[model samples]
Target: MQNSKLLILSSVWVEPKSSAAGGRMLQLIKFFQSIGYSIVYASTASESEFAFDLNALGIESHVVQLNDSSFDGFVSEVQPNIVLFDRFMLEEQFGWRVVQNCPDAIRILDTEDLHCLRNARKGAYKKGVLFQNEMLFTDVAKREIASIFRCDLTLMISEFEMALLENLFKVDRGLLYYLPILIENETIGKFDRRLSFSQRKDFVFIGNFLHEPNWNCVQILKNEIWPELRKCLPDANMLIYGAYPSQKILQLHNPKERFFIKGRAESAEDVIENARVLLAPIRFGAGIKGKLLEAMVYGTPTVTTAIGAEAMYGNLPWNGFIADDNQAFVASAVVLYSEEEVWKNVQQNGFEMVKERFAEHSYLYDLQTKIGYLNANLKSHRQQNFIGMLLQHHTMQSTHYMSKWIEEKNKK
Candidate 1:
């Protein structure tokens, strides 16, 4: 009943020091392995920069190169009962191969976020235009949805995306399951109201700058929003903190403007928890923003846009405020940052929300049970996904031949 062997094909190696997805995968691996499931992690990323030593965990590791025939052979040899694709991109790349070679294997796609939605929203924000449905019909949509349909099931990370997929793409509700960031119900000690916030100055914005939406938000704050906010709190500063900030992002730095770009944080938790208010005026993006979740966890209430706060607050009252228009967003940020009573209420609300939605006891237990059931019933589960089999039949003939052609070409 326990010791189920699982093969997890990741987009990158589980590098806790570098990757969020990698760290999440490691947690899942730990959970499964604890329950006696043997795990084999395979990825295309190089062995270096993989912070966690695979040998220590006793999980088998395989280095898979893209556009190669060797993968089919390797997968056929392993014959795992369940295959976990780290993200939709990985699923798009090797999903068909797994389905073709191991027809009975349960294919699970952990859609880190809806790529099509992210891509579309990014495109619109950069152009200073609004999102249009016609843009959704692009090639990414075809590939993204095809991967969703090809897999037996997909792990939906954001409730907003779950509804978007079902309503917009018409994906079967049965194929999508809610699986938010599963975190241990660790205590986020009482907010040190004296030093952390009362003494703190300025509005703070934090995110991974490599992400398009974050970079877009930086520009919005600098060119448009901050000037308005400073008018209200002229003595206050706005500190922008994030990881992997590019030179271009650093150039946004201006002492006179008081928009400080302090690069990557030594500790993400420390930066946000110490801030007076978290400001994320994200125009459009998909999935729940990790920074916002981190803010909530740190009890740092935020002032964000509709897109930034989407699906997270839900019917429950928001930790702080949601504003989209330029003037409204700036007004909300000033109020959240300066008003101690309002800030305290928002912070407490955030603490409750994280505890309610992301606590391990609520989502993880049920998810583990589902994963066990699916793994145990792999054969019958695949039978229900006839479209997966149909796709497998054709992809074996088409993609198999195409991969072979490329593999043969590489020899010359």
Candidate 2:
């Protein structure tokens, strides 16, 4: 059979080197391509200097407009076999149009992480309270869950989030697909290319500064974690690396105190491989962190909080010690940095976790099987998902008219 066409509506162009979401988007695109899908990526956001060159990868790119009729014409022309929304927001904007224009196309929502979960945790953190499920019932949750119900399948990045949707929100399992960040089988052999524990030096933290969690983490490191850690390991240096560091982030640099803020790593993996240990005192975030995953890939051990290591390891020990307590977190970092045996063991553990939890081949096969099965029995599947049908029907009428109203107003 000839391959089907896949269309992705993104909030921003993929920038793999700049952010974790970008990396995940690129991975998803490449996976579809590898499975013989003709891919086209469309977004409303302007292209940035750091955005990945989708055209260079032989994928067609289009700049779409929100609340416009032009998108209807584009969707009608493309008539994709599958439509994947990058996040719930995009799904909310264009999902109705897709349903109206190409009703047969299998609509999928890729929830990069549970935005509601992350937002709830962040809110609770700011309030100095524990995050509760009740906190998740926000306006964001309403829109995100509605998007999930409207789509044939929603890709979940974390197993934790999948369970939350099933048990807490009571979303059907068939509607949600658990597909974590996958590591290729070939990466297992690349461990040989990594620098040995002794060759690596200093503690490092890398993330996109634009992300609130990362910015909060850097503050926590500066105010709460680093002072204690520096006092303990006076000779040890902490280097912060990330893209688009704001002035506030840059101001944290103090060469006299052995804390250097190195903005924007040229190659995250290269810098990670050279680091003795990765320190991420992430206070609040969702999804698997790309930095933590990169550390494992580069054979670098890490010392992070329970929140930092959440849902990352399944039935296996962490690549390094996980401690939420600042003092203990500092102590773990000291040990991981000083002891070669401990660091080496943790590094090996990381490789094992990557192999077992994130093996690319297993996930690829699972995705292919799921897509093939859905394609063959989409009608029956849709019949079983009456709620999705209802939501789509209602969304079509409500969102459709509102979008058209805005489109008409823009012409005046």
Q: In model 2, which residue pairs have backbone atoms overlapping below 3 Å?
A: none
lDDT of 2 by residue, 1-412 (tens): 1578999998888988988888888889888888889999999998789988888889999999999999989999999999999999999999999988999999999998999999999999999999788999999998899999999999998988888899998899999888888777777779877899879898999999999999998898888888888888887899999999999999999998888899999899888899999999988888888899889998999988877888899899999999988889989999999999999899999999998888887688889899998889999999998988898899988998999999999999
Q: What is candidate 1's TM-score against the reference?
A: 0.91
Off by over 4 Å in 2: none
> Which RMSD values do the candidates have, in order?
2.5, 1.1
lDDT (0-100) at residue 24 of candidate 2? 87
lDDT of 1 by residue, 1-412 (tens): 3656789887566755343454467767887787777889898887765357887989889889888868989999888877988877888678778877887787888887888888888788778797887778778987788788888789887998888888888888877889776556545444344244576666788776667788889998999999888888888888998767899999999999889999877677677777878888888788777788878887788988888887787667788999888988888888888788998888888877877787767876777778777767767776776776676567668877787788889989
> Each model's number of backbone clashes?
0, 0
Score every model by TM-score: 0.91, 0.98
Name the candidate that leads on TM-score: 2
